[model samples]
Structures are given as structure tokens and as C-alpha cells.
Target: MELARWTLETDPAWNEPRIAAQIKLLILDALGVAIAARDAESSVRVGELIDELGGNPRCTVIGRKDKTSLLSAILMNGTQVRALDFNDVQYFIKEGKLSVAGHCSDNMPVVLACAEYLGAPGSRTMEAIAMAYEMFGRLRTLMPFVSPWDGTSVSGLIAAAIYGRLAGFDLVTQANALAMGAMRCSTPSIVRWGKLSEVKNLANALIAQSAVQTAMLAGRGVTGPLEVLNDRGGLHQVFDPALDFERLWAPVSEPPFIMTSNIKPYACIGTAQAAVEAALNLHPRVKDRLGEITRIVVTMADLPMIRKQQAEIHRQYPRSREAADHSFTFLPAVAMAEGALGDHQYRDRRWEHEDIVRLIELTQMEVSEDLARRAPGAMPARIAVTLADGTVLTEECLFDSGHSFPDRGLSPDAVISKFTAITAPFIPQGRSQRIRAAVENFETTEIASLMALLQ
Candidate 1:
């Protein structure tokens, strides 16, 4: 749990041009996703809650001119970023096992809030974000738990460290922040399973709020057991006993893990990215034979397929946007019908479209043992459309476009396009362009100036 000693020691990779560009792209992507989701039902509810629990204005909320408490700002901003589930992801081979460490941008709101509050430069914010990403990546690899909600816990740890560092806390205070944050970090698996709800999206926000409070407490001389991770009946005993401590404290490589993280191009769950791609690929062939198609079979890795099956409510009828986006059958069906899967596809009206619903009913999600075995490295999926004329057209997507797989990763221009497309709807075109330019030159800009433009 001595995270300060391990993270404060800077590595040269933190200053590498490639790593800096990757971090800027990730931050811009996160901001764009948050801005696009500013009006989302969940985000609106959270914003109202913040207004009701009004505190001294300390930091600016993204896409809003008003300011609020540091904790409230982090909660609202983090919720907005995750509202659409279109943020980035970090996957790695840890202890010889492939794992996803959740979305990297989950910790960015905390970093930005802290930096803006301190009047720090954007360069400093970027450095803090890089550190948080490294910490999250390392800890997630060490503790590969079953629940994806555990990523919220990892975000809490990273938030505490970032806030503590920005506040000029000592090593002991930083350690206490980690211990307190970890002690308070625990989420049930049900948040993401079965019928998804607003809680599924708010989980990270709740953790980010708690992390800011815990870090503040630590800065004010609050104390927590430093041996939180290694002690008996501590983090290891309470959750993820299989944690690989050696790997958790291991030295990182030159470019760091953020460079290897993925920026999602779709507005759905990460597991469904490849399936969506497959559906898009198959759309062209099935466009003319929509009425003639008898059934559509989707083959994916076992974990995702099982997740879709377990959400019985979504399978039968996805009544809410949250459930619809998480549904494997419904997502691909939307992609097949519309040739795309974006925020608009999850609207209540769109869900009622008979053709898409019929496509959902006709869809069959199957488990592919080969694909399941190749998971974490490749989220592969195959889609086959069987027409009434007995013609079966099929296509497979080994990796989603945004996935960081060798030459298959999304291009810089593609990332910028995604940012502009999502962000332009909420803000004016000129403002969107300014946001992009600020992020491009984030190294020289002040965090406050960049944040002011967000309003």
C-alpha cells in the first residue's frame, strides 16, 4: 500500500512524445464523450443531485458554466464521461493472463479537477493523469477480480494519489489516502449484471467522489492503516486474494500502459465492440435482403455471450437505454439495421422500431470456444445472416477498429473525427474546434484556460 514511493519515482516514459500524444488523445476523447452525454438522463439526474447538495464552488463542471465542490465536480464530470460507455479501455497480459483494467478515463476527471483547482498547467495535469493510468493498470493486473465494478475501486486509488500529490501531501498522507480509499471501495457485481440501471454508470462517479473526500481527509491529518494491501484481513483478504503483489509493484516499461489502452469508437459496452463491427461489416450484404433474412447468428467469446444471456430482461425487452446498450443481441441488431451503433440508437423511439426489434428476436448469440480462448488479446466475433433463399453471408471481426492491436488500432485522424462528431452536437463547431486545438497544445496551455473553454 506504499503507493507513493512506487509512483512518485518518475520514469522517463512519462515525458516521451509518443506517451504524451497518447495521453492527450485519451483526454480529448474523454472530454468529448462527457460533453456529448451532458444531457443524458443519468447525467442530468447527477447534476440535479449536485445542485441539491450545494457546497462552496471550487471547480468547474464540464459543459457547464457553474462551479461546485471538488467532490461534486468530479462526480458529475466522471458520470458524464461514463454515461455513454464510450470511453477508453486498458487491457494487458498480467501474470501470464489477459485482463481488462476498466476505462482509463475514469480517473481523468479527478486529475483535471485537482489540477484546475490548483491552477496547475495542463502539462502537470497530463503528468498526473499518466501516473494515475499507470497505477490503475498495474493494480488491475495484480488483482484480476470477476466484477468489472472493481475498476471503480482502482479509480478510487488513483484519484486519491493524484489529489494527494497535487495537494502537496507527504508520503504518509498519500499512503493513508490510498488505504482509506481502498477500505471504502467495494461494489457488488449486480451493478453490471442482470438488468443494468443508472447505478451501472454512476458506480465510477461514486468512487471518484469518495476518493476526493478521502484524499481531503488524509490531507487534514486523518490516518489509515498503511498495511492495507499486505496486512492480514485487509484488501487481499477481503477481495481478490489471488492478487500478485510482486507484479503490482513491478517496474513499468518505457512507454507505460496508457499508450497501450484503447479508445472506443462505439457507444456500447466494450465486449460488444467487435460484435458491432461484425454487424456493420455484415450490414452491406444484408441491406437488400432484410425481409428475406430468416435469422442472424452471432458468435462471440464465452464471457460476453454469457453476460448477454444472464441479462434476461435485456434479452426479452430492453426497456431502458442502459439495458439496450449492454444487450449483445440488441446492439448488433441496431448496427445491422442502421449500419451504425451510436447514442441515437438507444433512444426510446428507436427501441420501438419493429424492424430492429424483429432483428433482435431473430438474433442468436452463441459462444465460440476458439474466440473465448483468444479473449483479452482479441475480442473477436462472427456474424452470419441466413437469407430465405438459403444464402448465408458471414463476416468476422478479429479486433475492433479502436482496439490497440498492432496495425489495427484507430488512427489519430479517426480519433479526432470521433471527438468532433460526438462533441459538436453539444457545443458549437467553433468551440469544438477550440477544444481540439487546446488539447493538441495541452503541454503549453494552463489547465484553467483549457477548462474555461469547456464551458
Candidate 2:
């Protein structure tokens, strides 16, 4: 298969110093979210389940004292990383359309697990993650938003490739690994929309587990359709028939998708980040007159406005933390009223508060063609607050602060600040320092050493 040939010939490595540092930064950001989620409701429930399914305890559950089998640890760790929708995200915008999107860090736990299993060095783990992100971006160019296919559909394939490489699989076995896993990793996009659930947290984790198993099975001579990507009724036929299958084999981009992936500075989904930023920009000007505010108008990119602003019961409602992140309703309302957005806003069903609800009700969302043209890249948002005195205060955010493309990305110090902020409740100052240091000097550190700090 072409994928096998590419995997074998086009070797992966984090040789560039800048890319290496960025990879380490991504690791720190991922761990920040995963560690901070140690007490999240989903993490707690899943932690209980992981404890029940006790196995060899071969892998760390990450940011927790618990240990479980490799696969279980992947599930638990992945769930925790996504529990807060605070992990890093990668978006593929082809021809001004959002083709596919998801958290790049979703592949981190599985790679770390494989590295732990093989006693691999931190260098190998970094290269493996870089490869996974490259694959995610390449594969995403083919899986557009027009289909029901979710971003996790690429997770299993990426996970399989990582395992095959770490385990020293031959080219044939490696291709089979990807194909075998891809055939089984068809995830729907619904998990992330409309009253999101804990299932959203588990989607990528479960897909990674299956993908790892498929790769392992391939190592044992188990076979699957090698032509899964090109068969008469394959992925294109199943997802979007018009999908450009050739994008799957296109050369991986330089600097890779991991570098472009966003490091979220807020505790909300990517689509809402810019809107929240805009609202916060308008807060100081309108905070004192919040009660006098007649209506808050938020204009954003097309797709999200339609998907996140239509109706409350449909999905826009802040029914839960998951749904709240996707809601333009709760995000801007809180940001404007409080002048900040973070973990605390999601507590106590804050959206249910009378003032917040009234603010939410008074909020109106509209689509902007100019802004829509910039989406999946800049994610521009404009917030116009109308007052009782017939005055309109407006602010616009061209890009979310977390965005990392075309320069002006979050600085390492900014990333560190975010890490310290989110993880303060769970990780002590000394321990956080140690973790940060270990990640900074990741090339020489062992995979086990890094995981140890997380535990």
C-alpha cells in the first residue's frame, strides 16, 4: 500500500530545534489539561471503571495515582485530556472549508503508552507524536465536515501507525495495521454536538484502543483489507463520495500539523474561543451596564453559528460542561459579565443562574460571510453589545489567543502560565516545576521518567 511505502521511506523525526521545542510545548499543554482534569466528573467515573477492570497495571493513568493495563490507561488518560475540552486542537481548512478537526493530543496517551510498553526513549515518543499529527492532518484533508464522519475516525489509523513503528513492524504489517484499524474506527460527528456527553471524552480513547489492537493483531499475521482506502466502496464512498482520496498520500507538511495545533488558553471548545475573547474585550466597556443591556449580538463564522446557535434544546443549551463549551449562549454571556472565562464558570451549573440565563436569552448570534471566509484558521468573532441608551459597544477578535498558525502563537511563557493556572489545584508548585523541566529536556529523558512525573 502507498501508506506502507510512505511510512517506511519517509522516516519521522523531530530534528529541528524549534519543532522539538514546540512538540515539548504541546506535550506540556496536553498534560496540563489531563492533569487538571483529575477530579472532573467524567474522570472520576472512568477512574472507578478503570479500577474495576484491574489488569497488569502496566501503564500510568496520568495525573493520578492509579495504574491499569496499557489500553485502560489510554482510555482513562485520553478521557481526562478531553474532559475539559481544554486540550490542543488541529484544524484542516481546505479551500476555505473546514474539512476535519479534532484534538491532536488525543494521540498523545496512546503514543506514550506504546513508548512505555517498548521502554522507548523520549525522542522516539516525540517523533511518534509528530508522525501521528502529520497523519491526522493528511487524513483530515480527505474527511470533510460534509460527512457524518468525526475526527476520531483518523485516531485509530494514527494510533496503529505509531504502534507499528514502535514495535518494529515491516512495511506490509504496518500498512495492514493502518488499514485494519481504519476499517473499524468509523466514528460519527454527533458525539461532540448537541448536549455533549462523557461519550465525547471516550470517543478518541476507544478508537485508539481498537486501533492498537488491530495493529497488534496485524503483527500476529491477522489480516484485513489492504485496499480499504481505495476499494470500490471504501472510506470515500462511506464518508463523502466527493472526498479527494489523493490528499491521503500527499506529502506531509513541513513544521507539521502539531505546530499549527492550538493551545487553548480558555476552558472551552475552539469555535467559542474567539467569541469569548471578543466578549472579554467588550466586558469592561459594558460590565457596569449589563442590567441595562438590551441585547448582546455576537457575529461569528458560518458553520458554528448555525450548529451552535439554532436552539437550546437542540444543542446550544448549556445542559452540561461538554455542551456549554460549544454554546455561544453561555460562553459570551459569561465572558462579558465576568470579564474572564475559565474552569470556575462551568461549576454549579452557572448557566442556570438567573442573571446568566437572562443574559443568554438576550444574546443573539449571527453569521458573518467575511468572518466565515476566515474560519478554521483565524476564527474571527465580533461582539456588539447594545445598551438601553441606544449605544453599541463593539469588539472583534481576529483569532483566538490560543491559535498557533502563521506566527503570533502563544509563547512558551504563556503556555507555562496556562499550565500553572489549570494544574494548581492538583499539582504542587515543586511537582509542576519538575514536570515542566522534564518536558523541556525531553530528548534525554526516558518515557517512563515523564510518565512518572504525570503520575
Best by lDDT: 2
Stretches of candidate 1 off by over 4 Å are 94-99, 147-149, 237-242, 302-317, 369-376, 406-410
Worst 10 residues of 2 by lDDT: 303-312
Q: Residue 341 error for model 2, in Å?
A: 1.9
lDDT of 2 by residue, 28-49 (tens): 9989999988888889888999
1-455 per-residue lDDT for model 1 (tens digits):
44676655566667777778888888889999999999998899999999999998989899889899888999999999999989987666644545555787887888888888877777777778878888877777655554444556676677888888777677787888888887767666577666678887888888878977988999899998787777776777334646656655567764377777788889987777888998998888777778888988988765533444535765447877877877777888888878988888877656668887888788887777687686557667888989898999888887777776432334687689899888877899988888889999998988888888887
Off by over 4 Å in 2: 8-14, 98-100, 238-242, 302-313, 372-376, 407-410
Against the true structure, what is each candidate's TM-score?
0.92, 0.93
